[model samples]
Target chain A: MQVNKSDLLRRLKKIEGQVRGVQKMIEEDRYCMDILVQLAAIKSATHNIGLAILEGHTKRCVSNAIRSGDGEQAINEMMEVLRSFVK
Target chain B: MQVNKSDLLRRLKKIEGQVRGVQKMIEEDRYCMDILVQLAAIKSATHNIGLAILEGHTKRCVSNAIRSGDGEQAINEMMEVLRSFVK
Candidate 1:
């Protein structure tokens, strides 16, 4: 399934807000632990988005390739992406 | 700066081969140091792809948002992705 650009944009907007909030907290001298906690939450959210995108790619592009007898190619591509993603 | 899906797929395929090679190495009881080095290379490649995507997003989507007066939202979304990405 193709990802909706608008939907992605919307989610990104929310994330941007969260980032700014963190910056504000830092500027206000918020507790270090609190800032770290917020940072952790943001990291989780980001990873979730990555997983979602990866899932979508697997379901749509990769699966299609496999069905078309390009499974090896598809799997390879995914590995490449995963390599970078985990870094 | 839209990413070409085909290009992405091609790169992924290469990465897949590398991963399989790594697996094979492990199965063959290849030197641990050799395997670890390959693993590190894979990780770096993966992160590079992510950065490429992120740069594209920033240049295309995020920048567009800013130009269109949705800067706040765009930045937020990017931050969200970054949070997870670093984790």
Candidate 2:
């Protein structure tokens, strides 16, 4: 499964807007809790995006490697991605 | 700064082993809390990996883009990565 680059871009643009909004909120001295809420939303959005990419990668790259009798390599790649993701 | 693919691969190999260990723990009927603790460790490890990549990307890709007067593009790329990450 190929990653939908354009769709991902669109989502990212929106997220960027949200980030900027948060920045603005901070500049304007928004309540701490309110800012935290937005921050949480941004975090959740980011995590969702990660999950999507992970899903796609698993379906396409990892699955192909396994099918090709290179399961170790695929798992290695996945682990690499996950490592980066968690960091 | 280019990403250190070899180093990343090595780290990932370790994480892969951890994941497999977790699986084995499950199969062996390990305590749920113990398994969860391992899971948490894995999650933290994964997040650390992500942080490293993000740091590298920011110091290299994003900073370069800004220095070259392509800040918008860099930010957009960052947002895309963030989107994927949060999901």
Candidate 3:
């Protein structure tokens, strides 16, 4: 599946900013709780990006594979990937 | 608890590089699966950062709070933050 380039780039840039924010927070000797909170935000942002990518893949790649009657292997591969996705 | 400055900065720098790598991949129109995998790596790295900060907070702040006899609320707060950590 093709990536939504602009949406991805925009989201990634936001994540980049968030990561830098955490770095600055650390440099400033911010509270540990604050840093943890920021890290959680980054984690979730990345997770959402993964979900977006997965959505595209499912809507395109997986669907095509199924239409081609190669559905089982494609579905299995996707499930394996999804298994890795759980924290 | 104080953050381990050098360690965190180093890790964040690596993460910064990873984020940039993802941006480059997007620009090059890389495969969706590859980008998704990279995002997973970023998610794990951020999760580790959170774990490190949580470790320091638990070892120092939580311990101190307990020793000072305010253990309950401190532990409760930490648990609340942890609840958010799960994907």
Candidate 4:
């Protein structure tokens, strides 16, 4: 499951803009509730982008590794990422 | 500015368990791609938790600072976090 690189990048760029907007809202003394709403939106966008990448990894990298008998190592690598990701 | 502490904790705990599960999958030599899928799920959960916290901060902490004319300081704190977050 290879990722659609362009689509992922576009989503990431949109999230980046949203983050900047949150910062600007704070600087402008925007309403607290509004800022919070923006933050939530950004978070949701980020999660979506991560899911896209993860989907690709599962479809392509992981499957390839399993077929090549490198499944254990691939799993270990993913585990390492998950440790930091959750942290 | 106050978070629903219980909800945040519940989400974090779930993600923690997911991370542990990913590790176990690796230990058990579960399917490589399946492990990757699980890892992605953990990442998504962790992001949601982070968003919850960030929302609380914006609603409570940032607003409070603005009312007290500490808006600059509060914005700076958030910026610092964004720096690391986007990195």
Local distance difference test, per candidate?
A: 0.72, 0.71, 0.86, 0.59
Model 4, span B7-72: residue lDDT tens = 544554555455456445545556544654664565465455555656667788888899999999
Give the winner by TM-score.
3
> Best-fitting candidate, measured by DockQ?
3
- The share of true interface contacts that also appear in candidate 1 amounts to 0.00
Q: What does candidate 2's lDDT look like per residue over A5-73, in tens digits? A: 887888889889999999999999999899999989888788777766765665556545544557566
Give residue B49's error in model 2 in angstroms: 18
Per-residue lDDT value at B31 in model 3: 77
**Model 3 chain A — which ten-residue stretch has the worst lDDT?**
A1-10
Query: Residue-wise lDDT of candidate 4 within A1-87, one digit each (tens)?
Result: 124544544554565465556555545666544655555565555456545555667678877989999999977876676565445
lDDT of 3 by residue, B1-87 (tens): 234778989899999889989999989978777787788889888898899889988999999999999999999999888888864
- Let me know the TM-score candidate 3 reaches against the reference structure: 0.89
Error of 2 at B25 (Å): 26
Candidate 2: CAPRI quality band: incorrect
Off by more than 4 A, model 4: A1-87, B1-3
lDDT of 3 by residue, A1-86 (tens): 23478888988999999999999999888888877878888899889888988898899889999999999998888887777776
Model 1, range B1-87, lDDT digits (tens) per residue?
A: 125767777788888999999999999999999999999988877777776676556545754565456756665676568556656
- Native contacts retained, all candidates in order: 0.00, 0.00, 0.70, 0.07
Instruction: Evaluate residue A10 in candidate 4 and report its C-alpha lDDT on the 0 to 100 scale.
Output: 57
Best by lDDT: 3
